[model samples]
Target chain A: MTLYASSKAALRVYSESLAQELSSQFPGIRVIIVEPSGFRTEQNVLGYPMQIPRNPDPAYDSVREKSMQLYTSLDGRQRGDPEKAVELIVDIVRREGKSVERLGGGRAESPIYVPLGREANNDLEAKCTKMIQVVQKWKDVTDNLDHDDTNSVDLTRWGALRFFFLGSLHAYRAFQDRIRALASAGF
Target chain B: MTLYASSKAALRVYSESLAQELSSQFPGIRVIIVEPSGFRTEQNVLGYPMQIPRNPDPAYDSVREKSMQLYTSLDGRQRGDPEKAVELIVDIVRREGKSVERLGGGRAESPIYVPLGREANNDLEAKCTKMIQVVQKWKDVTDNLDHDDTNSVDLTRWGALRFFFLGSLHAYRAFQDRIRALASAGF
Candidate 1:
């Protein structure tokens, strides 16, 4: 589960970066991330048979049992209609039917993400909310993690020189500001 | 850069999950994620050379040039002290020196993450802030993505049965609530 979840997360981030990277050079190119929840596919319905692992570790027994039960029970009972999902996806891509209205009649930019079901939407929203909450909770500690003398005049010349020479345009500008500040302070 | 960044993200998430998974069974075990920025190691200082690709594409020429210039200039001038970073990491893991006070005299739990430099802290904070801003911007759309008839009585018996039989404990509770609601509605 951990591996699967992490891989999915990596794919999601990669897609997002791809979308951003392509947007400036290729405005016509659209990268839409479709997150579907429990479509009634053959795999979801009957492919997941309960099979105990031959060398299952004792520590993971409970989790294994629970997951097995869950998958077996959910088989063939998923709420999502695969055919309807396909139709909607096609419509979204072609800008037809109700999707045209939802997409603002080809005037507005399409959303980067389109969660296809109630479960998908809820799960995504929950994850986002949880992330926000965790970050907020640790905001103070995270903000204060910098070295104490980050802005001190005692910053080494090598440090300043590196920024001036090798840094991006933004870093160069910042280095210039730092130099100006140091000069004003008679350093 | 995208691949590297996404892989790092995946590793971070995987480590986080590992920490959570092991916490219950292994109370004595600690998982520490150290994010260091621009340490004056050989790699940061002199390892990167400005090497042009043999078959460079014209489209990426600008970016390639900029990155090369940036890296070459920054060589040997990175601000972080590798020795100091190592010392700090050791102190944190050993619960010694100033870390004792910072960690509350060995009574409080150690932080799961230890960002090592000013740049790392600022970048992490910025990332978190940006994430919060993006999620907030799309809150309405995300919250409203559920199927219109999510709570309708038309939900198939198979769907309810799946939840009752195979779902997790939380899902089971949610199903019970839905069933009660349906019963009250004279379904």
Candidate 2:
């Protein structure tokens, strides 16, 4: 499970960088990141129970045993609909496929990302929100770490700083509202 | 440049996970992630000037031209002290080599990540701080995405929640602080 999760995470990071890199050089060509949840695919239809041994070390035995039980229970029981997910992906790609003509006839806007299943959407949304909150919840502790080389804070600039900060914050809020609205609309 | 950056990012992610996986599974094994900045390595002594053309499209020619110029300039002028970096790594590894006995001649603490040069350290620190700020700046917008299925807004739990949140947040802050401090100290 650790290795599997790690691989998925690595792909996520790389896919993001790929999207960024491709954006300017080839605006019409997008590498959409499709986050697929577990679907009832041939590979996931477990034939037999998996063998998960607890760590040999007594210290890690508890976590190992808990993980083993959870993994064992998940075999053949995943709820995602793989076939429907594929159809949706194909539909999206077919729509975006129009953009290939846009390069000369290039550039079209396809959604940057698509979360495949209900479960996947929920997980991704929650994780994104939580991570955002984590940053919000700790902003103060991190914001002041830089050495004060200037030796003085510009008290007069506070008015301008606050205005700029609030303006950016408002724009950010609008963006988030759109994301949530879209997600709730079943995108 | 895009491909190079993407590939390096993926490896960095994979190597970190690998070190974590090995730390628990095989205590005797150690994986070191060496962040080598542009060492005056043999390959970097470019035999010839690199050729980078400005994009043909009139739209992106400016950025392409700028990037081409920057990349062309960095060919062999790297300030990294590679020999000294290697010597430092060797010394660190030697110190950890003694820990193998703790695992019954088994594993040593994975060299948790070693940044190899001053440039590498600067890049890592800047990236980390920026990421944290991004998360913080947009937290409020992301926080309200989910529908409030149960809108009681359990105000009573805020006390405990705040404590737990702060605890986790503090730990996270400490970790970041250590990273920057270590980078500054020439790790």
Candidate 3:
């Protein structure tokens, strides 16, 4: 089974659990979870309008403007080269439709500093590569499972859901971290 | 931009609003949505279990068991072929990497209907498919701004939250429909 999710945060949660769940059930089936980083897609730009909750007070106008600027500046630049993203997606889909897990990211990651292309570097391509790696791991683990009895596999009642929720929690934590960083900067 | 979603239901919502919002921003970019059918993957059999709102009760045991039996019957049957399902997903992901929508299904319109390749025709696949189609149509109409342009695109003041609330209403309506069906089934 192959799945594509647009939001890195949302899709990661959905895909990971799905990959894990499928791995346990259909032992030999191929499952791929593709997580494409920010793309210049409508979802990133225009899927949902930035609905401010209230009229910004004059005091907060500058902050609002800055936030809007940060968002709008990403207009067509936040995603990787659209063409390459398409190519990578096609390649993954065409593969034997095996159990695979891949993530598409635009560029390299730097722990201490942001990459040059920032979030837009070959995001989809990188995600695709990671998905491939995940699928390979899944394949390897299950291939060895053949020696073990399927009866021994105690399937979780909702393992997939738990994995998905965990991913969401992780993303939430990441968001919290970013907020903390921004707050610290102000302080 | 191409987009891929895990379910047609998800794609429908993703594409409709996303395309509607960004259509004006990026004229040349193409938005693609893919609706893939159900497949048997590790996750399909088991997903993160939903956090039940309340404690489980013995009274609901029979109901849950019936639901489970209905779901298990459609594993490898008419709902969808896993290989085909993955192939469709990969194709859409590649072709619509910029923007993609996809979905999976198991249950049919009626929970009672059971096909031969039972493994593929589960309840989740069916609902997932229906959900995709419904959401697609729902979002398409909601995003249409021809009726009142003035109220359509404005997101400067509390508009985002207002729209979110409105969307939630629609979702609630959909959920109600599902509940009504279950009620009629004597659940």
List of chain A TM-scores, every candidate: 0.69, 0.61, 0.38
Residue B177 displacement (Å), model 3: 29
What does candidate 3's lDDT look like per residue over B1-187, in tens digits?
0111233224434554555444445544445432212323323233323222232756545435543543354222212233333333334334443112221132111101111121212222442343344333323222221222132222223233213322222222333454465569785
Point out the worst 10-residue segment of candidate 2 chain B by lDDT. B160-169
A best-first ranking of the candidates according to their TM-score comes to 1, 2, 3
A73-105 per-residue lDDT for model 1 (tens digits): 555555555545555555667788646655664
Runs with alpha carbons beyond 4 Å of true place in candidate 2: A1-10, A13-19, A22-68, A72-187, B45-68, B96-111, B138-187
- Model 3 chain A worst lDDT window (10 residues): A108-117
For model 2, residues A65-165, the per-residue Cα lDDT tens digits are 65445435433343444444444444455654422332123354432455443334444445445434433432332222222343322212322211121
Stretches of candidate 3 exceeding 4 Å from the true structure: A1-11, A28-31, A41-44, A47-60, A96-187, B1-187
Question: Clashes in candidate 1: how many?
Answer: 1
TM agreement with the true structure for every prediction: 0.61, 0.43, 0.26
Query: On a 0 to 100 scale, what is the lDDT of residue B90 in model 1?
Result: 59
lDDT for residue B1 in candidate 2, whole number 0-100 = 37
Best candidate (score: lDDT): 1
Model 3 residue A95 lDDT score? 35
Q: Give candidate 3's TM-score.
A: 0.26
